[model samples]
Target: DAYGAIRANQGLYLSSWGQLGASGDQLDLTPARQQLDSAYHLSDSLSQSAQDHNADALDSRQNLKQAGDDADDRYGNSEQLSDADQSNARGATDSGGRGEAARMKAPWLHLASPAGITLSTPESTHLAQGRSLSISSGEDVNIATGKSLVASISEKLSLFVQKAGIKLFAARGKVEMQAQDGEMAFTAEKGVKVTSTEGRIEINAENGILLQSGGGYIRIEGGNIEVHCPGAADLKGAQHNFGGPTSLTRTQPEL
Candidate 1:
């Protein structure tokens, strides 16, 4: 031990120190060493006890919550079963009309916790019978699954992100955006710009493309040659300016 020296000649040895060690040889440190070991052992035992107590408390809380939820579900179902039995007796005496309705009044199975309801593996979960899946959150909700994510809306779907923006990235497959009604609208605070890195950029409008300015009327500036049309061209507006002819300007189209 660093705290003491050992005198050894046989199996039985005594621990002491030279007269010039940290604590002088006249100063016995065996009691101090034993006191330190005892203190450390006591501290470790207390820490372990506290940790075990905390773990047990957490497990007990979880089990209590689960038991309460199960009791609620059972109570609900039992109440419904009592009502159904009465209905069945009444229909058996009356005409056959109410008998069919009694059989249809079966209770749905549901188990809910304070957090949320979870349908276990054997239980199948259906949302509004294919109507819509809506969620309202106070803070944030995250979903992680090992399967696919599909959002199919019949009528209209709207998303509004107030604080941060939304970004969509496709790693492998294509990104397809289609409006069956052929009317799509996008508005941004600054502006909307679309770019392509590798492939060509194509814009197709069944009718035609329209560019209009709200504040100022219109302004067209080209660093080199801006406008290009293959077929026919027409300029019909309140005011039109055919800029000075340069190599890039061709007011006429080929036949």
Candidate 2:
């Protein structure tokens, strides 16, 4: 109802300043957008249609042309492209140039619901970021999967706790941590303790297990316990127990 305002027969409204109002189940922009990189493409050349799609196209066309440069540029230089292909490439490059004018320009999309916003797909939903991806919540952020949730990283995976401690819990299954090709080290400033509530704690090594404190050390290996210290060695217990007979053997210390 304003100057340069237009309304389509399908209940779609367009403002003079390039704002669109559509309440339809589907609003098609294929007439204006081009899918140069992915299965979907958007371009600004179709400006008479919608300003939003035009701006998006302008923003994406640069990347599309850069991607096309790998193949299209070669075709353009080698004189292998047909006339029709050359024309289309020229058009795409022009549109992409317009897109690069506002490089990295992306629309700010806001979707709000009174209850919740749910995104569900039958197959899979993938997300990628050129820089960093961050998710934060005021109350809580929760991720749930009925089957499996996995993450693969090329560098390293790190989790930092600033307030409370961190917890890994499996209600029924086992929780495992392994360093296949490297060392697995757990260091605590205060102290560290490993406990089993109702089961046993087993530390098995293929070679040996060494407990070292200052200049003293206790080595357990080959079904034998060896203790050595530069100072005094004291063993205090109400009852002295041994699996087999104990004997004193004098030999030079390994350390």
Candidate 3:
């Protein structure tokens, strides 16, 4: 048989050999000789405490391997199947072993809701990793609350966009970034611009600052500014003003 069923009119009352119900009544339920001798039979059922006709619970702990690898148990095989045994089983099922294909069904567990479904628990809920956990939706997947959402990472955190670039927007508050003991870098393939609609665009560094492009650089260290250009240096303004004493060691043509 591929499956078995046990139907109850009110509720299902089930427990292990050493456990009891809520009323603490002892039920002498023993396993058969074959069941006691099976490798998958190694389990300790804690208890299933339920009222007469209200709820149902199943508490048990078994060997992890029994749950992970029980394909032989499902097929009523006590041990690993040899190549001949597998061929014989396939021959008994159908032509070209197509009988095995009948066992394959849809592998997804789909949950649809018009009104949503929220999960709430007083204790912690964890998703342990077998491979990885992925979340996807047809439209938007959002995580938002009235309070803050914080993520503390031990290693690096990465965000990638295939088409549209990433955007960080704060409706009321300002956006701030800091690197305590390391460096913060932003690299773009095209152009990079720092703009302020109403306020000023300011760049301040405690050590120094360097703005370089096309083999030229403008280095600002302490109170000194060094400008180097492989091409022509252009200064275009209505008025040329220098607050402090200016000295031009080498004068080149302005273009």
Candidate 4:
């Protein structure tokens, strides 16, 4: 018949109009304290479970392999993965807000985020699989930084594919490709052009040459050009401006 309001820090409390009978530590004591303690531990158990799922996804750093290859990782096996292994993969990726496809994409650096992750080592990171690598997007995907982007590939196979394209530009420096002791070939379906404003250009081939463009078998343009043809040459045009050595041997048009 005295209190008009009530306050609490550990458990619930209520007071109004002289009829205060609430199950709280401030009103009752032992039963409310025991109930609140149990509830707090129950929440702790659930939080621990969610952390385990996150750990399962990223707790993997195994030897990654592909079809038809030798072993790089000594501890991990080279045989096929089991069904349980695949299910664990799904749980691991989905914990990080990703699908199971993220498992297949980790060998290469498929990092996409704002903060980003770092891979630092003294050795190299190798992608030794015989399969192809694919990067796709529904919209424009940009890779940018405050520094330069450098890629060094040690081997060269057939490097182009039809219906797919890649464009690269350097704002300050030159874009250079060097094949050590081999030749470089550039082919276009429509046309090919080599132009320079303040520098000279040169093309040298040890074997024969075949150029197909502009209704002609061979077209050359230079300030003071030098062409050496030994076997045979074909020129198809109404008018051609060709200047060669006067002792040019065995020159015949195969028209």
Backbone clash pairs for candidate 2 read: 34-41, 35-40, 35-41, 58-99
Looking at model 3, residue 42 earns an lDDT score of: 29
How many Å off is the CA of 243 in candidate 3? Answer: 4.6
Every model's TM-score:
0.36, 0.45, 0.47, 0.30
Model 4 lDDT tens row, 1-255: 776954333323222313235221123222323433443344344335545543121111112122101111122122334422322333333344221211111122212222333666886677665744423232355877576677776653323322346677777778667755656667567866788778988554433455553444443433223444554556598987868655323443232
lDDT of 1: 0.40
Whole-model Cα lDDT of every candidate shown, in order? 0.40, 0.46, 0.45, 0.38
Instruction: Tell me how candidate 4 scores on lDDT.
Output: 0.38
Alpha carbon RMSD to native, model 3: 18.8
Who is ahead in TM-score, 1 or 3? Answer: 3
On lDDT, who's better, 1 or 4?
1
Per-structure clash totals for the candidates? 0, 4, 0, 1
Regions more than 4 Å wrong, model 3:
1-74, 77-140, 243-255
The numbered model that scores best in lDDT is 2
**Ten contiguous residues with the weakest lDDT in model 4:** 64-73
Please write out the lDDT profile of model 1 over residues 1-255, one tens digit for every residue: 459754423212123323343322221223333433444444344445545543221122333233223322111111222223323333323433222221111222222223344446765556564332223344577987677888786555434444366888989988877665466777767978898889899654333444555432332354332344544456789987888866433343222
Candidate 3 C-alpha lDDT tens digits along 152-201: 98765544443466788899987877777778878777988888899997
**Between candidates 3 and 4, which one is better according to lDDT?**
3
